[model samples]
Target: MKDFITPDTGTQIGTLALQNPIMPASGTFSEDLADVFDLDVLGAHVLKTIMHGMRAGNPTPRVCDMPSGMMNAIGIPSKGIDDFRDRMLPYWAGYGAPLVVSISAHSMDEFVRLCEAVSLPGVAAIEANISCPNIEADGRAFAMRPDTTHTVIERLRGCTDLPLWAKLSPNTGEPAEVGRAAQDAGADALVVANTMLGMSIDVASRTPRLGNVMGGMSGPAIKPVALRMTYQCARACHIPVIGCGGISTLEDVLEFLIAGARAVQIGTATFQSPTIMARLVTQLRDWMAAQGVSSLGEIIGTLEIPQAADGVWA
Candidate 1:
């Protein structure tokens, strides 16, 4: 007897299409785990967020466990674009999936420079990390205003010819507005969020947890928040939305799809199980088959949200 787990469903991020919608979050899925599982089996691969300059990152005690998911203040430690191109790109090319290299910088000039540098030979696409703190210049906040998100993509648009995806932050007051900013700024896609900001403390020591005072929270705990934001943002803009934060199971992946996510990225979950991506990919296909769904695209965003008694879809 034959099995029914074949991925008949397919999707694309910009011009680079994918066999499935599941992918790992940047930085969380490292190149060091090649032995544990086959990265080629994945639909796509996004390299960790790299910067124009090398990053030492914040202090130790970087990660901690929370009730639903894990929290981290990793501080975006990258080897820099030049070094990443020299080393990481080679490994990225080895993987069969589309290679998306995430880049971050403080100034518009540095962002443009980094985009130009990394759009080298092997990069399939470039994802700009605008939420990072400006360690050298001023302070750092999630690219709160739409203007900053717009300006960064606009500046980099002229520099590199590669497809651009602006990674948005859920810590914002309005995710949809920022999504539109990315669209207007000429971004090919938008990552609905990086991580929501949350902090924890140890009552015993009377100090905050994690190396940094605050950090981005990701895991099963944030799934509902990510789902709602992704849905709203997708409806607000024409660009595709790559759902991140708290995506753990096939059910979670389905919820994101129904909520309007074109694709989903798996994070914190990977730290506990490197093979989760492959497993989830398999499960998605199997679930699709059981539902008599020929193509995943056929069911995406197809949820017919019933109108309220007052006749409002809300």
Candidate 2:
């Protein structure tokens, strides 16, 4: 029999060490998946975004299927922080993987409050879903600009000592700037990024498909855009960047790692194949062993680009 070496797939996001770099994106993962596979195989478990109060979320028909992906205006319907602490936290504690609580709020004060509340013992890290609307910014998302991103992250940092991962928005023109701001404000890592803003029309009804008229686009279609942002942010910030977008296969995961992302998050792909994340973990190990790569450090941030005619890489 041909001998194959066992590849080491461990990775770290700030001070929190992970067994592997494969983890589900916030809002796409839950405890129900435990039936499909062992959750401990994952690097981390990022729960859906929770708020201070319960939310009904967006109106019906909030999700629409696109050719290459899907759009959602879920409005972050949460059961509030109370239920998460009393119910959700314990259920997740049963799993060995590190728990990463995702939190969102409309104001800086609320964000700080939520951060403090979720900074419990079982939780390994906190992922700030700053892509949500900010009432203080005239309904604009806090991650839409650098200053707001800095303020929110800084406040969250002050409230907790747990690892802070700032999830950025892809809708902005300056992703690198926003990422740097989060880093400057003390974000331990960056989930680069959130879904892109998009809309679809129902040709038959002559009206918008989503009840909210528009929603965040995610899936294979946004992979290129997300990959670009990940590469940019990973280069711009000193902290690690966890790529999140349309990763469904080993090749996709490898591309993100080569682009400088320390890790990658699987979202819409999980809806299509619940067992995809686990399979990717196995696949990554097999691929690494076959390629004679013993560790992930050989793949992460290994992208090489030839110089342009003007002597600039870009």
Candidate 3:
């Protein structure tokens, strides 16, 4: 009979160590999930975006159904930082997993202020959602270009010593360029992307499906794009790239790791199966053991491209 060995699912994002690399994406995960399964069983806990002030979010029908996915323009509604620190922090403090707070802002100063406020006790790291428009930059997302990416990250970097994760926007044409800028400006890691911009329409009524007219698309449809961005940033930057978008299964997690993601965030898929993240954690371990893999790091960025006879990569 063959002896069994436990496979190591542990991974790190900069200096932060996690038991595994599977975490629920921001906005999708909440304390409610703790009732479905043990929250401490997961790799890390990522909260929804917290802003300087509370927002009501977009109008009705903020989320619209799409083929193999969904779209949302929730506008990052928040209950303000004070409420989160006073009410939510204590609830999460009891858990063993690291708590990562996601923050969004419209200007560099606001970004810095939010970082400082969220950098309180019990917080493990900060994820800056640069996908939001920068009021200082005429409504362009801070991650849309390299210069702005650097400036926003640099300012936020100074505001807090906690691990800073720059979440990039898929709307940008140059993901790699912006990723490099974030790393150079002292970002500890990168969340490869947010959802891609998309919209749906009602043919009969001649009305848009969402109240905001446009929303960010997520689910299996965006996997290819997220995978490509993860590869680009992982290749271009020194920081770890945490892949986000369309992840729902163990195979998806493996695909992200092979594309150079140190970790992955499961978003829209959670809406369908609340227990998905917890199941993946166990399945990932079993699969790795069966494949004779001993460590998660062994598979990170292990993709091999074919080469031509002339010594060029094909």
Candidate 4:
């Protein structure tokens, strides 16, 4: 029998240390997953985005299937902070894994308040879902521009001493700039992106498939775009970058790691197989041992590019 080599999968995102680099993206993760696998096996448990007040969310027909991915305008329905603090927090505290609370708000003040509320003990970090519409910016996402991204992060920073992970949006033209803004404003890490804006029409009905007409698209189709953004942000910012998008397979996770992401989030894929995240953690360790790699740091940010005769990257 071959000797079993236990590879180290541990990784660090600012002050928080994860047992592994695999975790579920916000909205895709929930307490229900505990029935399928041990929640403590994951690097961290990133809860679904919670709001300041109870929300009904968007109208019906909020989700639509695409050829390669899915679209949703679920509008971040939440039971509000009170329920989260009173019930959800205590339940999650029982788990051994670190808890990362994801929060969203419509205004700058609301964002700060939400951050402060979730900054209680037992919470490992706060992932600010800044991709949502900001009323202060006329319904534009706070992450759509560097200025607003900085402003919101700066204010949130002042309200909490907990590590803040700013989740960026893919809709912006200046992804690197937005990432840098978040880092400069005190974000400990950056979640490379949120879902891309897309719409699908039902040809037979001649109407939008989603009730909201447009929704955030996620899944394998957006992997390339998300990977690119992850690479760019990883290079532009000094803070660690957490890649999120269509990461369903081990290869997808490897690509993001080489692209400079210190950690990666699994989203839509979890719907297909609830045990995927847990399985990937095992697979990663096995693959590392086979490749003679001992730690995650060896694979993180090790992409190599060849230069042409003209001194340009080929």
Q: Write the per-residue lDDT of candidate 4 for residues 163-262, one digit (tens) a residue.
A: 9999999999999999999999999999988999999898999999888889999999999999999999998988999999999999999999999999
Compared with the true structure, the alpha-carbon lDDT of candidate 4 equals 0.94
Better of 1 and 3 by TM-score: 3
The TM-score values for the models, in the order shown, are: 0.93, 0.97, 0.97, 0.97
Candidate 1 on 110-223: residue-level lDDT in tens?
788888888887778888887876444365543666877787889888888889998888877888888898889899999877888999999999889987978889898888
Instruction: Give the worst 10-residue stretch by lDDT in candidate 3.
Output: 305-314
Can you write out model 3's per-residue Cα lDDT over 151-189, one digit (the tens) per residue?
999999999999999999999999999999999999999
Candidate 2 lowest-lDDT run of ten = 305-314
Query: In candidate 2, what are the lDDT values of residues 1-314, reduced to their tens digit?
Result: 54678899999888988999999999999888989998889999989999999999998799999988999988999999889999999999998999999999999999999999999999999999999999999999999999999999999999999999999999988999999999999999999989999999988989998988989999999999999999999889889999999899899999999999999999999999999999999999989999989999999999987665464545
For all predictions, the C-alpha RMSD in Å is: 2.6, 1.7, 1.9, 1.9
lDDT of 1 at 82: 67
Q: Rate the local accuracy (lDDT) of all candidates.
A: 0.83, 0.94, 0.92, 0.94
lDDT, model 2, position 228: 92
Q: How far is 34's C-alpha from truth in model 3 (Å)?
A: 1.1
Candidate 2's C-alpha runs over 4 A off are 1-3, 309-314
- Model 4, residue pairs in steric clash: none
Query: How many clashes in candidate 4?
Result: 0
